[model samples]
Target: MISQAAYGAEPNKDRRIPVTVLTGFLGAGKTTLLNAVLSETSSGKIAVIVNEFGEAGLDHDLIESVEDEIILMQSGCLCCSIRGDLAGTIADLIERRDDGFLRFERIIIETTGLADPAPILQTLLIDPELARTTRMDGLVTVVDAANGSKTLDAQFEAVSQVAMADLILLSKTDLISAKVTDALSMRLNGLNPTARIERPVAGQFDPKQLWGLSGLRKGVRQEDAIAWTTSAPEPKIDPLANLSGLSKPKPVSFAPTPHDTRISSASIVLDTPIKDSAFDYWLDTLIALKGPDILRVKGIVFLEGIDVPFVFHGVQHIFDPPVPLKNWIGDDRRSRIVVIARDLTRPELQRSLDMLRAHQPKTGTKEEVLLGHD
Candidate 1:
């Protein structure tokens, strides 16, 4: 863990304090970047919110921000309780600042590797109270240049993070050759084209570049919507192309890799509004049976009685209540739901969703709809 004395940033007082959410896969150098920024000598006072202080056991270091840390996160990923906790923490921080207990000009939230950043971003964006004081600056994701391709192939979490990033940081360039680094960058660009790619030389880069990421400062507009919806370009070179020399030709399939063969994602769009009761029954039944296998579930639903779209985010068995959006941002009014899970298939999820929309009672022999069964 980076000591508090080592972390510093130049404060910006001219605008509303921007809250940046830092995310990446496990061992993507997030801690290293946090340490680098926090340990460095600067004029800004930045407050950092982490899941737990014991994960890396840095609480004993006697750092400067110990009292300032928000310990609201659970041992695992951020989920149901996190929305309220995050809102409360930010509100508390603002209160303390108002009382002159905190002098920080900016804030950064470092999420766990397995954590999904969508809910956190939504909380900052939709929470009326938090939005008044702090706006979402941007989402910065770190990718390990040397082994990032394999990580992305194996972990849906990594792919989602890359897909959602405003800025992709290619870390540890010094450990890999230019060819490998360039190939990884190409792969990343294929995943997200609008994100600015930054390469850190010797694990160092200017902190200023991380702030002021476009589109996230306010709410999701047409431009912000386009950033996520843009089509990814095809890779110039296959990441596994160089490995053909020592191994036999690999079998071709629709699967990404054997590592993530059990993990899959499915997107569903419903043209008609769903009754709240039917939606709840479907979600409750699905989560009750397959919660552990479900990694992350997020969607915007056009409920029958609601004029505005409702957003919901879930991790494992824990889920936050649906949050109503102010209004639909784009012309597309179809309700969209994206589910990522382990040992799951798109057909099974789509079937489950269909059953839910129909309000059909679950049959005991429905094991075929779940992963690892049929």
Candidate 2:
């Protein structure tokens, strides 16, 4: 645990404060980073939020021997599946500040390895409500220099984790030889050229390095973070199942022995444009049917004659209104859909869409058959 005497960053007089993000693959030494920051910073009075133990338990584990250390974190506040919704947790810190619980200069959040950095950043960047109160300093990634190479090669989450860092710490390099360390450093640089790399001796150096966050940031976009090597459900599920999975044994929407769910995701590319009204009707029916199960969806659509691709992001039932993009990221102009959730069958979702789309009426194209208009 970094002591209060070690911290130096004072709260901003007007409105700016640094909030450091401590992220890395599990057991990569994020706790070590927190310990370093807490123990060495010249700043006085700092607050830390972590995921491992009750927030302060992580603090205590970091510097367990320090007798004067006063650490505090409630268990209820620290949930297991907490990824990036720390915006709510951080908001609580402001309340505590008003009540005088602690006069910390900076805020630190460490996430579990299974988490995605994009959503966390989105909670910071996209949430205009939270942005008003907090400003992002930078992302600090603690890398396991010893076994990082294998993790990167094997895990999609690891690649995403490394891709989103602004400052990277390569810990435990001394345990390995110089040659292996140099190779890993090069690989890290290739993944994120912008991040400054520091090989710390167990985070036992000057705390000034992690202090300033002006240099740590990236273009606010998920294009760099989006990755999918994993496969979704089989290609047998119906398109209408996009709304509701085939749960009923009696066959409500074509039950095929229960492999997929009611709310499924499928990618579609049209040679021609879809009528705006028709698209709305389809979306409406889908949501009405099974919006509850639609976990996350990302797609780039080439709408009829619209030159630019339409980018869409949706979480569960909530969706960001579609945004027009200047162009697609790759050669395949066809739409790409990444659906993440349980009980979803991709094949049924696609077929239902195909049939419904074929049934569109020709009065400037609207849903009369599906909506029972004519």
Which candidate leads the pack in lDDT?
Answer: 1
Off by over 4 Å in 1: 1-27, 35-45, 49-98, 109-141, 149-168, 173-218, 222-257, 327-331, 356-374
1-374, model 2: which lDDT tens digit per residue? 01122223333342634667778887687766666566653654456666645432354443433212224433112212133457666776666666965456666667777776656655765666556666566667888989887777656567556645657888887787655666677566544444567887753576667755432122223353222211211122123332354453222222211222222334443434554555556666656665654544444444544554455555445554454544235544444334433344555455446644574334323211100000
lDDT of 1: 0.61
lDDT of each residue in 1-374, candidate 1, tens digit only: 01122123323332567888899988898877765555444526676676665443332232432232442221111111123488887787778778976567777888889877777876775677876677666789999887898888878788778756778988987897655776677656544554678887754577777776743222344444433323334333434434544554333223344444555555555666666767777787778878776755666666666565555656566554444445356555556665666666666777777754464223311212222212
lDDT of 2 at 203: 35
Give the lDDT of residue 186 in candidate 2: 58
Root mean square deviation (Cα) for candidate 2: 16.7
Best candidate (score: TM-score): 1
